[model samples]
Target: MSKTEKISELKTNKTRKVAFMFNDELWQLFKQTCETNKTKPTWEIEKWILNYLDKNNALD
Candidate 1:
């Protein structure tokens, strides 16, 4: 198989780590919003980042 095919066939069971810092009030608000929506803040953030990347064509 070619490099592109090999790369495409690759799968990972690993997860990446990331960190962020924000205002205490903003964090509280974010937590509350996630709880009210019955979802996790991390999940919401991941969805938001994916949407943003897709909109900007950053994934390409």
Candidate 2:
């Protein structure tokens, strides 16, 4: 019933972490655009991933 064991038992969801680097100015512009549209950067990245997968016929 320690903290580490409790943490391990709580991890019931499956999700992968996606990461990458971006140019400073371009990243700032992208964040500003998403903010103007009331969207988050993570949501935009997820949409881009889905579109890429569909375009490449990689989705199951």
Per-model CA lDDT versus the true structure = 0.71, 0.72
TM-score for each model: 0.70, 0.68
Q: Per-residue CA lDDT of candidate 1, range 1-60, in tens? A: 654453343322226777899999999999999999999998788768657765786555
In candidate 1, list every pair of residues with a backbone clash: none
Model 2, runs deviating above 4 Å? 1-14
Instruction: Tell me the tens digit of each residue's lDDT in model 2 across 1-60.
Output: 654453344343337676789999999999999999999998788668557765775553
Q: Which candidate wins on TM-score?
A: 1
lDDT of 2 at 9: 42
Residue 40 lDDT in candidate 2: 96
Q: In angstroms, how far off is 3's CA in candidate 1?
A: 20
